[model samples]
Target: MSDFTTTRRSFAKGIGGTITLAALGSTASAQTAETWTTAETPTGNTLYDVERTANGVYAVGAGGIVLHRTDTGWERVLDGGPTGNGNSLYGADVTDDGERLWFVGASGAIGEMDVVSQSVDDHSAPDDVTNNFNDVAVTGVAGSANAYVAGDSGKVYYSFDDGATGTWDYTTPGSGSAVNAVDFYDARSGHIVDGNKSVFATDDGGTYDKIGLADANANFYAVDSDGADDVWIAGGGGMIHHWDGAQWTPADTGDASLRDIEVAGDDGLAVGGGGVVYGRDSDGWNRQSTPTGQNLKGVVRGGVDVAVGAGGTVIER
Candidate 1:
């Protein structure tokens, strides 16, 4: 195992409210129009992931913070739950129609929030599971009962009835790798990336097949699919892999640990450690200037591109 595996695993298990903003400033880049702008957040806690909801954008982070973007700015919609553990929320996803939101975080905590009613339901992990849930992926259609949550120790839980009726079915890919992120092209097909620098795909929502990679040590932190044929995976050591329907291939982005990525149409942006931000277009990948030096953890494509990171940093284009 790589040295990062141990350190990242420890970091994931540790819980704290303190967040330090890095001193690194924006680096010189080719795209110099200053497309990115910083927005104010309610807390300095580290934000792990962001997703585009129907009404606007929602960011999840340390201390169970959930910030919703309004027409004016960002607002804290949810703090620590009833237990007050303030378990850090790691990843979140919105249903395709944008009516519901699902989030996963520390100690296998799962939450579902209604976009219209603004009601939230906090669900606890089963007795046999105690590992932190790192990410979640929901189906595309409204009232869809299928959703998948993945996390530490290759643990994965599938809720065929949307956790409203039956209990969630669980499975592990047996890689024993910490599943950092998951994305589904549809209800039946999906992909997962892990801390062991491995990737897997599932078609029946249960069994997964390991996908071979050019670099065996590439620690993937995030995965997204424009379609089953077109998929992108980003990770540590500045690694980005593209799956073109059949196989995975490397895409150059220097040696930076990319924590999250967002792709829209033919354009894509990836942000990560050291305030690193890269944009890809028809021309290719070009480094983009970030306003803050904090490690960017999550990004989403919308009317404007927005990226969030440590120390309550929010950057929009």
Candidate 2:
């Protein structure tokens, strides 16, 4: 889903149950990330993606709550959140300038959190034509600005500029598959993952083209660009696929149920349903052992690597 929208975004279905911190992966213990501490959970449910700002760490999860973590500790900015029955919150991302922060999940539920005032603007079902938002990205497009949220039913919601609210001209580029993840280097070019293991790319931001991956039926939750030329995908079945300007290649992280991935540059980190982290390099893939048993939902680079998920978890490496 969103690359982890397993971090998956638009595809977070309104399902019930406790997601074990480490149940859906390769069943192997990784190296130790002992220095990492688990951030307090806002609610006891699935948390997709997180963003680090100059003030604090803004994390959104089920039950419509926004959790803020400063240098001191974690606290809830808003108590039980948005007016919706959707309990699934999938993917989240902030602007490059950290001015706008957006969260998307099941039923097309999206919450844009203002970092300065900590105010929120919500878009849910009815406001959202399709209620399956899995992941999102904020890009500076020519005619568009703000950010864009992607989800199931092949729908993408565009923001006005940066993270401001705007008209959502939902468009299904080429295919009708559910988009688990979305990222854009610019307004014109971006990439998305459908339910299948395949990946789609758009050069004009209008039409999307299909690209083949090594694994089939592999559910991808997260994706990021290493410049516009290099792309990476993390998904279920321990599948880690990459594109190097030319073609997509498979890089085995040794776990099948990979949840999400993100890149600071060519360097990236992959997290799975298991408590594992895979760092890929020129030679091959290296594993990082995590502390808690919780499945790592999302990975992002600020000063360090931050992985977040269930059981009130947040890990930094």
Candidate 3:
């Protein structure tokens, strides 16, 4: 492990309420805009993963429902929406090619939706390998077609041919189970968290090796790689791990179950249960306050903009 140390700091946004985050993003431009609102058809449903594009903001949740937001307002894409099905969406992937819009959720629901055509068709996986995928990651390379989906039960599936089909390769890297999140730098090198505790990395993409960190039993939920060597992972009890080209070491953000995290440019944001938002910079960790108490499931960024997750809980930073 690299001998890097992590430091935690606190901040007060002076807006609505105070949130305690270990480290918060300071290098990125903080949002002075307000983009928080309750979803329509308020059936008391929860929003899982949220994504924004040049068009608008889209969030889907329980009950086979989809919600879209434009400059106008939020609207239900389904006729009656969340209409029954009781299915929960875990994650979404917007193709970087500006070609496809895909969504994945619990119960192996994957689709390629036609934006201009207003149609969505199922994307299939192998029989014995379908999973309640927690997240879908599009290979962030130009003209790349691979998208990987991860979830419970030590499951990890990917498609170099773009979620069409692939060899069923499975592995349990540790004693604690479930691969909650996965990210790839090229197609060959990446890392995944074992129930937010331990991390496993693969230099060859087809095979894997474990990098023992300073903390054990750290339940890490999410992982992201800026390059083959530059990677970050976040998880349970608020443990943050960064691979600084040499080794995987723990970056101190305290412990608090940081469920989801996003890194934009040099800045990053970590969100988790309890309306929590942690911002990171060269100095590391500051809390952003908002008038929310819902548990944030995920955080992502587009441009200098940021979006957070909670049940029907969406905030722009």
* Candidate 2 structure quality by residue, lDDT tens digits, 28-56: 44344444556655467656677766455
Model 2: residues >4 Å from true position, as ranges?
A: 1-34, 82-87, 125-130, 141-144, 159-166, 214-217
**Best of the candidates, TM-score:** 1
lDDT of the structure predicted as candidate 3: 0.57
In order, what lDDT does every prediction score?
0.73, 0.62, 0.57
Location of the lowest summed lDDT over 10 successive residues in candidate 3: 1-10
lDDT of 1 by residue, 1-317 (tens): 00000111100111112222222223347565657888999999999888877767888889888899888899998897313479888888877677777888887778888866667876657544657989988875446647788878787788776765356787787568788888776665777777777677787788777764544456888887676556677887776777655555566577789998876556788899978898877655677877788999999876767899999899998
Clashes of each: 1, 43, 22
Ranking by TM-score: 1, 2, 3
RMSD of 2: 7.9
Please provide the root mean square deviation of candidate 3 (C-alpha atoms, Å). Answer: 8.9
